[model samples]
Structure formats: structure tokens, C-alpha cells
Target: MPCGGGESLEGDAAIYRQLLSISGHRPKVVLICARATELPCEEIAAALLALGAGKVETLTLGARTDGEKPAFLETVENADAVLLLARQPLRLSTLLGGTSLARLLRRRNAEGMPVAGSAAGAALLAEHMLAGGESGPTPRMGGVMLAPGLGLSNRIVIDQGGLLGDRLGRLLAALALNPFALGLGLDADTAAFIGPDNVLEVIGSGALTIVDPADIGHSNIADAAHNAPISMLNLRMHVLVHGARYDLDFRRPLG
Candidate 1:
């Protein structure tokens, strides 16, 4: 699941409930707070506990020593579910990009371990991550920056805090460059739960915008100069409110 930033503990009740249900009730949950430099472990841990997590362990990847790395890896490997906290996506990529923990997490996810990320955590779940970009009304040639991500999911590129943050331009820019990939713009307090079959179920109070460039006819992205506004046609968009569903592979709304 990918969560937009600013999800309240109360607003995320459904997500939390789903996580527990997927884990077969009150499972061991590992909170990855590597990206959140300002958040305290106690605060996050308390929230998870309140959410009914049986066991909540936090792994701080930011200031770890060589000796401490092995322990972190072990903790993650044993987790029933992994929850990535809010933070900058780049921070996560920089710290855990090629580490053993990264590989372990990927392997676990493949083995069907539940994994969910919020905000930057959500962005890092994609193979092509949205690093940074300017938010505006129009798409521009160089308005969005892309970077390598954790590769948890490759079919979709996610941008959290979407309409709330005016990040539609960034999502569009990403889709224009990676036309084969679908773009998801998540508003604050919203989330997309993508199953193994690539069906995404929307949850929370806000909306999730889908930017599909698969049918795009024309674009000046290749020829446009830096900071030049992009010209594109036939870009498809869909707005999914709470309880809606979409299929990423088919690129269509699912009723």
C-alpha cells in the first residue's frame, strides 16, 4: 500500500485493519523510520501499538554503525509486516539502496510479506522514484526528477500528497518520460492498496488520481528545452474517491 502524506491515525484505520488482517491478526510489525529524521521512535511506536500491532519494532537506518546493520537486517527478516514511515524518498535510497537489508526486504516482499509505505516511503516502493520537482499547473520538460528506487513495484510510479501538494505536474512529467508506466497521484489522507495481481483499491477520505499516458499521441518532451512547458495530447486521467478500485495492468477503472 502507498499512502499520501499527512494520514491521521484515525483516518488510516482501514489501512491498519487491513494490515492486521493480512498478517492473520496482531502480527509482528517492523516500522522502517530511516527517512524520517525528525520523528521519534517512541511516537511512531506508540501509534502502532495503539493500532493493535502485537509487536512493533523500529529500525533506524539513518545513523547505524557497521556492527548495528546485522541486527537491523535480522529484525526485518523476522517481521510479519513492514511499514515504512514518512520521509524524503532520496534519504531512503541513499541509506539503504544496496544494503543487505534492502535485499532482505525485497526477498521478503516477494515471499508475500506485507509491506506498506507512506509518503516518501510510498515513492521508494516503485522502481523509478520521483526524487523531487516543482509543483505547478502545467507539465514541463524538466519539472520532475527521477531516481532509482527499492524496486518493490515497477508498474506504477507514485506521488504522495498529490492535489493537496499540487504534484500533478510531477506525476505527468514522470508518465511522459516513462510512458509504459502508470502514474498515481495520492492526495493527503489517501492510499492505494496494490495486490499481487496489480489491482489497486482506494481507501481513506481523499482521492487518488491516475495518470495514464499509454494513449498519449504527441509530446514535445524530447525537444523541449529545460524549464519549457511541455505539450502533450491524449493523456488520460481518472479520479478515484474512497472505496473505488482500478487495475494497473489493464489501465482501467474496476467497478
Candidate 2:
């Protein structure tokens, strides 16, 4: 996926190009609606078709009468690529977790099928999930929550809301709790595409913030007073714009 400043025609073009490459050109695409209702997917579907996608299908989990049927997994298996359009990752994950559909999507992704998500949809594409949180300016106890995700990507922790509103505090709170994972705070238009080589490429007109906790010296997260600001030292951060790439394995930017 790609994320940046504002969604522009140029940004959308770049994003589609990347998607095309990831799924092997003219790939069969599956659009998974992460909500119960119709997601207003016509625009996205049309775009994929215009980009020469071989086949584009939508599997709305809750709305369909044939819920979680074996045919669903077969659809996932047949597709060369998948994209999720989500509004709330927490709620969607709650509905999909422990089900065969989730398992199939995970398995297909592991087998090298390209998978991407929109801003909110991107949240569940990681191992450490930012479930819910209130937006604030500083790291405070009970301001953010974390949960297990669909395991599409394990090394990064993803938070995809209120980024445009300066939700650094929320992302920081998440990192404080799950220090092992890198926190990626994404703006609405931001799209981050992490490839098999573990390199993250930022796309779109919006930017994404990468918070690395590897250099942490001290953190009062556990001992901090509830609802009070957290004191964390030596937290490393990088802000990346469109076209910038980060090598996740080495935790460094590439030229």
C-alpha cells in the first residue's frame, strides 16, 4: 500500500503501478470489504479494471447470504492479489478473526499473493494492531489500545487513524507498550507498500511516520500514573514522504 501528503492523480497512478507490479501484471484482484454494509466500491473496482486487472471480484463477508462458505476460500486461493477497503480495522478483525476466510487470506499472502489495504484497512495487515484510541497531543495512559492483527505483516505495528490530526501521542503509546514492533502512523491518503525484500515504499500525497523503539534507554510506561503522560527516552523516528524507501531489516532509509 502507499501513503503521502494529499491524494493526487499522480499519487493514485503511482499506487496502481506498484500494485500492478506486486501482483504480477494484469493480476486477478480480490477486493475484500471489511465492513458489513456495501462499501461503495464501484470507483475502486472501475480503477482496477481500467488498469487492466484480469478479474476483479468483491467478497463482502457479512452482507452475503452464503456466509463463510468454502467457495470463499476458493475465491481467495484463485486470486493473484487482494485489497481491503476498511473503515475500522478493530471491528473488521473482530468479525474475521478465527474464521476460515481470515486463515485463507493469510495463507494466500504467505504463498506470495500481493495484499494491500487502504488507510484503515492497512491497520490489520500487521501483527501488532492499534485497536482503538482517543486522539491527543501527548502520550498518556489509556489513550491507545493494541490488539493482535491478521498477521499479514509481523514486524510492524500499524495505526491508521487521526494521523492527519497529529496522533503521534497515540502511536507513541502503542510503541511504549509493544516496544518490539515498529509503529507506522499513517495519514488517510498515505499508502505504504512493504515488499518481500522488507523495504517499505511510501506512496500517495500524504506521509507516514515510522517509530523505532530499538534505541530506547528508559521508559516509564509501565510505572507511569494512569492517564498521565509517559516519559520515554531515545525513541528513534523517521518521517517519509512519497517515493522515499526504508529498509526494514536494517532500519535505515535507502537512496
Candidate 3:
């Protein structure tokens, strides 16, 4: 979920409702804003409550319960659905990296719990986290920074502000550096809901861009020139609209 802001969750009501429904009636939804406390917790929690979340408890990483590891882990474990808020993915990764909360998220997802995120929160869900960097219309060397993420999904490099925000260039540059990775560029308001079967179902009103570098035959990223325009060949690009599904395991669009 790239743009699930205050006016945001309503747009993806179906998915929200479904995630909360997993608890049988009303579910316990935890909004972990440890990444950035500035996110609209009240608004987001209200939306979740409206969507049938039985209880919504927002836990900030460095706030009230910074030392309460067991309480934090227990809350996450008992929740039916957990949503990590947006903004400053690098900080989020750093904060959660020191705690068991991030690891618990991975374990919960493995056990079939609905762990979700929005915007920068969405980016950190990838194994290779896109921390943040310069963005332009053209690809450039050293435009992005890559860091280890929560390892929720290793298949794609989740990027925020896709075509709409002119960050595709950074994503291209990232893929060139890590050619083994796939660039999943998400525009504002759009989301790539990767299911248990490794099928990514596109959601929201915007589109998802898939940058595949598996067939790269050439590139000048080796120069590592600062702010220098990059040149690469044979990187596959796919723009998927709402409702389109891609098989992440096979790295192809589904018919």
C-alpha cells in the first residue's frame, strides 16, 4: 500500500475489511507507527475501526514502551492484522531491527497473519530495502541507497512514488546495481498485494511498474559516477493496471 493516508484506507475498503475479517468477527488491528510517529494514527485507526477492527492499538517504537519488549511482541502476536505506517523507511528499519517486533512481523506473516504497510512502510517490507535517494526522470548512478530490510519478501525491490513522483530513475539505478532484484515501483495510492502463493495482485487506482534486469546485456553503472546519467540495456519494464496479477515466483504476468 503506497499511499494509504487518512483519506486513504477507504479506497481499499475491500482489502481492509477482508483483513479484519480474518479474526472471525471483529479483529485486533495494530498500527505500528514506530517508523514515523508523525503519521495520522487517529485517522488511520478510525478507518480500521470503521472497517471492523475490534481493537486498534497504536504502538510507537521509541515511545511509551520502548523497553517493553514482551508487551510489544505480545500485542503483535495477539493481533489479527498489523499495519506498519509510512515515512522514513530507513529509520523504521533501524528502529525495528533492534527489536523483536520486526522479526515477529515476519513470523506472523509466515503463519498467515495479515501484515500490511503503506508508502515508505511498504518499501521496508522487501528484503532489499530502498532507504531513499535522489529521483529524476532519467536514470543516474548513485541515485539510491540499498539496505537490508525486514525480509518479508525477497522477490522485489519495493519503491515508493513510482511514475507519478519521478522516482523510477532511482529504481532503475537500483536494479542496475542489484541486477538480481526486481523493481516494484508503486505510484501513489497503488499497492502490490503479494499473496501467500507469491502472486502479486495490484490494488488501488494507480499502476505498478515492474523493472526486470534479468536480461541486462550492458550498463555504465560500474563507473559509480555521482549524479551521472546511467546507461543500461535490455532491462524489461512492465506497467500493470489495477486487478492485474503477476506471478513473482515465475517473474511473469498471469493471463
Model 2, stretches more than 4 Å misplaced? 2-11, 35-38, 63-67
Would you give me the overall lDDT of model 3? 0.77
Question: Which residue pairs collide, candidate 1?
Answer: none
Candidate 3 — which pairs collide? none
Clashes per candidate (backbone, < 3 Å): 0, 14, 0
TM-score of 3: 0.90
Top candidate on TM-score is 1
Per-candidate Cα lDDT values, in order, are 0.81, 0.76, 0.77
lDDT of 3 by residue, 182-241 (tens): 888877667677778988888767778899998999798877578899898988889998
* Deviation from native of the Cα of residue 209 in model 1, angstroms: 0.5
Q: Mind sharing the TM-score for model 1?
A: 0.93
**By lDDT: ranked, best first:** 1, 3, 2
